[model samples]
Target: MANRIHPTAVIGDGVELGDNNDIGPYAVIVGPTVIGSDNWIGPHCVIGTPASDRGAPHPAAWHDAPVGDPEQDGFGVRIGDGNRIREFFSVHQGTKRPTTIGSNGYFLRSAHVAHDCRIGDGVTLGSNVVVGGHSEVWSLANLGLGVVVHQHSRIGPGAMVGMGAAVTREVPPFTISRGVPARVTGMNVVGLSRRGVSPEAIAELEPYVIQGAGELPELPAELAKLLTEWAREGHRGEH
Candidate 1:
């Protein structure tokens, strides 16, 4: 199927789009940004703008528009398939590398992903959520409304962050985090159970979430991979 792009939308140069995308009115997708299939980009959403740094250059995104220099265009954004990006969301261009968003994501209104952020598959970011630059939100993680993730932080796979929390540090996998400076309060048992994780495995992962230092109990291959990554990243200031 063909893409449905509103005439009022601005698709700048070097922007590549796959099939079946729905781009709404007044949305701006600038150059160097690559978007995959089946994406719903809502009104007023912006993607692949310049990095947030004050000194960064704004490269020309349009085709031969002669507005800005394309030679200095540092890096752009790469978005995967089946994403539902709601109104007023913004994804900034990367400073060092491409700011990447994985497949099957749902970002609510007024959310923001700063430069160099990495978002994994099946993630849901609620309204007004903001993630600082270089942060990573792993697969299946759910962030509630108005959650603010600090720079260089990681929210591990299947983690759940409650609304209005300010995450100053990393969040471990399969955990529930909330409050001002978010800390792991409990396991994400509901999420785990919904994903069909066995009770034994969920119980075993509890210590890993709580203590943040221990041998991981036997889990499914994917869960094990996520845990290993969490360990390697080292729950930086999880408390």
Candidate 2:
């Protein structure tokens, strides 16, 4: 089926939009961008814009340069299928590589995704949530309204960030985080259950959750592996 783009919507050169897209009035889609099928792009939303730091000076001189050819330059936004990007949402293109959003994501009104961010499938960013540049939000992670995630941080899979929280560190999988600096509150029991995680698995992950953000204890193979991976990534300063 053909895309239903509103008459007032502005689609810039080099923009690649797939079939069955519904682009609302006044939505601006700039090119070097790839948007897949069945996306509901709301009014006043902007996608594939150049990074905010395009004017900042760097030793390589490429940092301040404008996006010339999106495809050739390999700098743009890549959105997968079935996303609902609501009104006033703005997603910036990558400065070097492409900023990517996986399938079935929901970005609520006024949510902003900065340059070079990686958003996984089934993720939900509530209204007014701001994800800084180069952040990675894993699959099924939910950020409540007004949440602010620091740049280069990693939000693990099935994590739930409370409303109005400021996340400065990496959130573990199936965890609930809140407060100003966003400390781990507990295991995301409800979230895990909703995801169909077995009671046994939840039990297996309980000890680490009780221990909080510090050193984790030895756990079952799967849980231990995940915690170990998170620890290794944490040591690399990704938080």
Q: Give me the displacement of residue 158 in model 1, in angstroms.
A: 0.9
Off by over 4 Å in 2: 54-72, 207-239
Q: All predictions: root-mean-square deviation over Cα? A: 2.7, 5.2
- The list of candidate 1 runs beyond 4 A from truth reads 60-74, 232-239
- How badly does each model clash, as a count of residue pairs? 1, 0
Residue 113, candidate 2: Cα error in Å is 0.3
**CA lDDT of each candidate?**
0.87, 0.81
TM-scores for candidates 1 onward, in order: 0.91, 0.83
Best model number under lDDT: 1
What's the CA error at residue 87 for candidate 1, in Å? 0.9
Candidate 1 backbone clash number: 1
For model 2 the local lDDT of residue 126 reads: 100
Tens digits of per-residue lDDT, candidate 2, 131-210, equal 99999898788999999999998898778999999999788777889999998887898976765667777876655544
lDDT (C-alpha) at residue 53 in model 2: 91
